[model samples]
Target: MNNQHDPLSSRPLVSSQEYSEVKNEDFEETACEDSITQRSPSTELPAYKLRRSAWYPDMRVMISREVLAVHLVWLLILAATIYVLGRFTPEVKCGVSRLPSDVVFGDIPYQIVNWDEDSGFVNSDPLDGKRWNQSREWADSTDWTPWDDIHPGSWVQVAPSSKLGISGGIPLRDYSKDGSWDTNDEGYALTMHHQIHCLGLMKHVFISAERNEPIPSTSFRHMDHCVEYIRQSIMCYGDLTLEPLQLGSSQKAIESDTWGSKHFCRDWTALKEAVWERSTVGFDRHGFVFDKVIP
Candidate 1:
C-alpha cells in the first residue's frame, strides 16, 4: 500500500520520528479538574482600526463622551448666534442696498396706491363728503374737508425711525401759525394734507367759463406760491417715461399723455400701515405718549 493513501484516514496521526523524540512529561497533567480548559484572570483582544467621523478630528488623546457632547453643543450655539445676527439685524445703508432688496425707493418713501375711481385722486367717479363719517372727532358734523382745514390749525403725529428719509417725523408746522400737533384748532395732518390745503387755496382762485363760483381774492402771492410749488413738484418727479412724440395739428408736438404710464413705485400700502402704527396721537413734555397733545 502507498503511504500517501494511508494518511487520508480520519483518525489523528503523528509521525513515528517526532513521537519518538517527545518526552512523556510533555502530557503530564492528569487531574480531572485540570484536564478541562483553564483561564487566566484577564485577557486582551486584538487591536482594531478605529473610525472617526469626518466632522471630528482624531486627536491622539481620547475624547470622553461628555466632553465631546459639550463641544458639539458649543458648535451648535455659535452657528445659531451667527444665523440670528445675519437674519434679524436691519441694514443701515440706503439707496438700492436697503434691507428689503426687492423694494426700490428711487423717488420718495411712498406706498403704491392706485388712483383709480376709488381714490378720488384722479378719476372723478369717487364720491366725496365721506370724510366726516370716518373722521376721529367730526361726529357733530359741521362738514369738514382738507380744504376747510387749511386755514384753521390742526394736530399731526410723527415718529421718525430715520430708517427711511423722514426724521422721527416732519416737524409739526404751526399751521395755525401757532404750530401745534393737531391741538385745539383741528386734527392730524401730513404732507398730503398740506398739499391738499395748497391745492384748495389755488382752487379758490382758479376761474373758468365752466360755471358760477365766487373767486376768493386771497393774495396772488399764495396762489402763485401754490402754482409754482405744484409746478416744481411735477418737474421734480420728472416722469422720464418715453412718451414718443407724435405728429399733431399743433407745431409743438410735445403732446405727452400720462393716462396709463406705469412707473416703479414704493409699497404705498406698507408705508401707510407703518405710518398709522407708529403715529403717536399725543405726547407729554418728556416725549411720552399721553392724552395731552404736544404743542
Candidate 2:
C-alpha cells in the first residue's frame, strides 16, 4: 500500500505522541465552581497595522488615551482662532458713506423748475405741480431735503460703498436764486442733508463753498483736508448729540447752530457774528456763511 494514500499507514501508531495529559495543578481547581473560561495570564495579542487619517501625519509614537484627547482639543482651538481673525480684518473695501464722484462743478447735473411760479418756466408734470404737502415741518428744519423720506422727487441715489463714481449723497431736488418758493419739500438747503458725521464731508465742504461765493470746483486736495477736518470735528458726535432735532430752549442747548459745524449752536453764532463783522469792516472780502434754516 502507498503510504500517501493509505490512512492507517500515514497515521502514527503512538497515540501518546499526539496528546499530552495536563497536570491537575496546571488546571484551575475552582474552574467548575466559578463556570468561567480559563485563560493563561502570560498570553499576549499579536501586533496589527494601525489606520490613520490622510490629513494628519502618522507620528509613530505610543500615545495614551488622555494624551490623544489633549492633542485633538489643541488642534480644534487653533482652527477656531484663525477663523475669528479672518472675519474682523477688513478684506473688502467700503466707505462709511458714499463714494467719490467724477461729476465736476458747473456740470448742470439736473434742471430745477419752480412749480409755484407759473410765469417763470413752462410747468412740467414733475417740476411744475404741487407734488408734496407743506403742512408738516420740523422746528429745526433746514433748507435741504436730503433726509426727508416723504417727498418722492427729493432723494438722490448715493453710492455709499465708494464703488460707484458718485462722491456723496446728492438730493434730487434743486433750488437756486430763482423765484422758487415752496414749503412742499421740493428742494433742500445746501447744508440740509449733510448729517453731523465724518462721512460725506467732501460734498459738504464743496456745497458750503459753493453757497458762499464764486469758488472753483472742489479739488481733490481740498477734499482730503475737509475729510480730516470732519473726522476731527465729528468724532465727538459718536459719544454725544452734535445736532439737535428741534428748535427750543432744550434744542438750542444740544443742537448745533449749523447742522455739521463742530462748534455748538451758541459758539457757532458767535463765530458767525465775528465773520460778518470782519466782512463788514472789509477785513475779509468774503467770509464764511453760517446759515441755519428753521421751519
TM values, all candidates: 0.37, 0.20
Candidate 1 residue-wise lDDT at 163: 32
lDDT of 1 by residue, 172-245 (tens): 54432345445322234454445555665454344321336554455467778777877877685675555445
**For each candidate, how many residue pairs have backbone atoms clashing (under 3 Å)?**
10, 9
Q: Evaluated with lDDT, which candidate comes out highest?
A: 1
Question: Model 2, stretches more than 4 Å misplaced?
Answer: 1-67, 86-142, 147-295
Poorly placed runs, candidate 1 (over 4 Å): 1-155, 159-189, 207-209, 247-254, 278-295
lDDT of 2 by residue, 1-295 (tens): 2223346576523322232233334233333322343233322221221122221233434355568989999999999876654333323234222112222111122222222323222211111122221222331223333312222222223223333233343222232223232333222222222332223334444454656735445545656666676666667445343544556576555544433433312233333333232221111111222111222
Tell me each candidate's RMSD, in Å, in order: 16.9, 22.2
Instruction: Show the colliding residue pairs in model 2.
Output: 100-166, 100-167, 101-167, 143-188, 143-189, 144-188, 144-189, 145-188, 244-255
> How much is 168 displaced in model 2, in angstroms?
24
lDDT of each: 0.41, 0.33
Predicted structure 2: lDDT: 0.33
